[model samples]
Target: MLYIIGLGLCDETDITVKGLEAIKSCERVYLEAYTSILMVPKEQLEKFYGKELIIADREMVESQSDEILLNANSLNIAFLVVGDPFGATTHTDLVIRARELNIPVTVIHNASIINAIGACGLQLYNFGQTISIPFFTDTWKPDSFYDRIKENKDLGLHTLCLLGKKIYEPPRYMAINKAIQQLFEIEETRNQKVYTTESLAIGIARLGSSTDQKIKVGTLNQLLSQDFGPPLHSLVIVGSRVHILEIDFMRFFAVDKQLYNEIVKKDYGI
Candidate 1:
């Protein structure tokens, strides 16, 4: 049997009750370190789980999965993900391969950033297509996400931006500043009004951690200069008018109140 377990968003304690049980029972436990990560260190998780787990990097998972799955025929092997197991597609492929090998599989789920961004004071149901902002390289800047953000804005729906996380090495998180810059650069070239520096946005960081934070009613200009702190962050761009209660709730962590209020009225449709 192969178990795909979700470690939730913050720390080791965030693991679901069922997932923890499987981790303790599994013969070999592996942590998928690439896609996303908890706020705590791997050492903390080992102490909590009471198991000697192997760290699986992208190279190993993509090239040496058979090595991890080799002895699972009679043993219970578990692959732990930082968020809900299916939040990333790489995890989905692992399950498919396990099925081909006739291994019975079970998924233990938990909170994922996909639905966790509601803390930004926006209604979850008002969200449209979610897009990822990738790290721009010198020669390969891509802004294809602009079209989707525009499409969502046109419909009066919010846009959730899942900033890219690279797991090939130790996980490297893309900051919101870089994301905004890349988006505006593309908008600049395309002559598009889809997104601009003055566009209203929200930045949330460390979603499930004790010190988790949210900054509401910021513009691309204000948001780009602000640091949300830590990795594993996400940003949201509100499409149009929403319940004023949402804005009031998010104001508790407002970084730049005067500017935020201005943008919220002009862009967020107050």
Candidate 2:
């Protein structure tokens, strides 16, 4: 049997009871490290779960998956993911390969940023297509995601931008400030007025972690000035039609409550 388990959003303790049991029963355990990351290190998880883990980086998972699937038909192999197994399409492809090999598979689900972003008080149903913002290079700036964000904003829906992370390279994670700068560049080029420096945005860092988790609600210009420590950060663009209750709830995390209230009332017409 092959077990694909989600480690949830936080540290080792965030693993579900069923996931833990599956890991304990498995003969070999592999931790998928490229897709997303946990708050704690792999050593901490090994100590907590009392299981030795083999780190599966992008190269191993993408190019050498056959090795991972080898003997799965006879031996129990556990593939651990930082978030839900289905969060990344790569895992889906692995499941398909396993099925072709006649290997039975079991999936364990857990909380991911897709749903946990609701902690900011935005209605989940109000979110449109989520987009990822990759780190831009001087010669490789891509604004294709801008069209999707525009579509979401046009329909009065919120946009959730998942920043990119380069694990194998220098281990660079796209920060919210850089994301805002990219968005501004796109807006300037398109002139669609989708958003501006004064746009209401939310920046969340180290979500689901026990300590140093930060949430700041403010304009893009304001957020750029403030520091949100660490990686694994996400950004949200407020929709045009926001409920008063959401405004009230998000205000708790606002950098300037007065400015947030004014912007919501004047621009969002809440």
Q: Compared with the true structure, what per-residue lDDT tens digits does model 2 show for residues 39-121?
A: 78999999988899999888888788788988999999999998788764448668888898999999999888888889888
The lDDT of model 2 is 0.87
How much is 186 displaced in model 2, in angstroms?
1.8
For model 2 the local lDDT of residue 124 reads: 94
lDDT of candidate 1 at residue 41, scale 0 to 100: 85
Best by TM-score: 2
**What are the TM-scores, per candidate, against the unseen true structure?**
0.92, 0.96
* Worst window of 10 by summed lDDT in candidate 2: 164-173
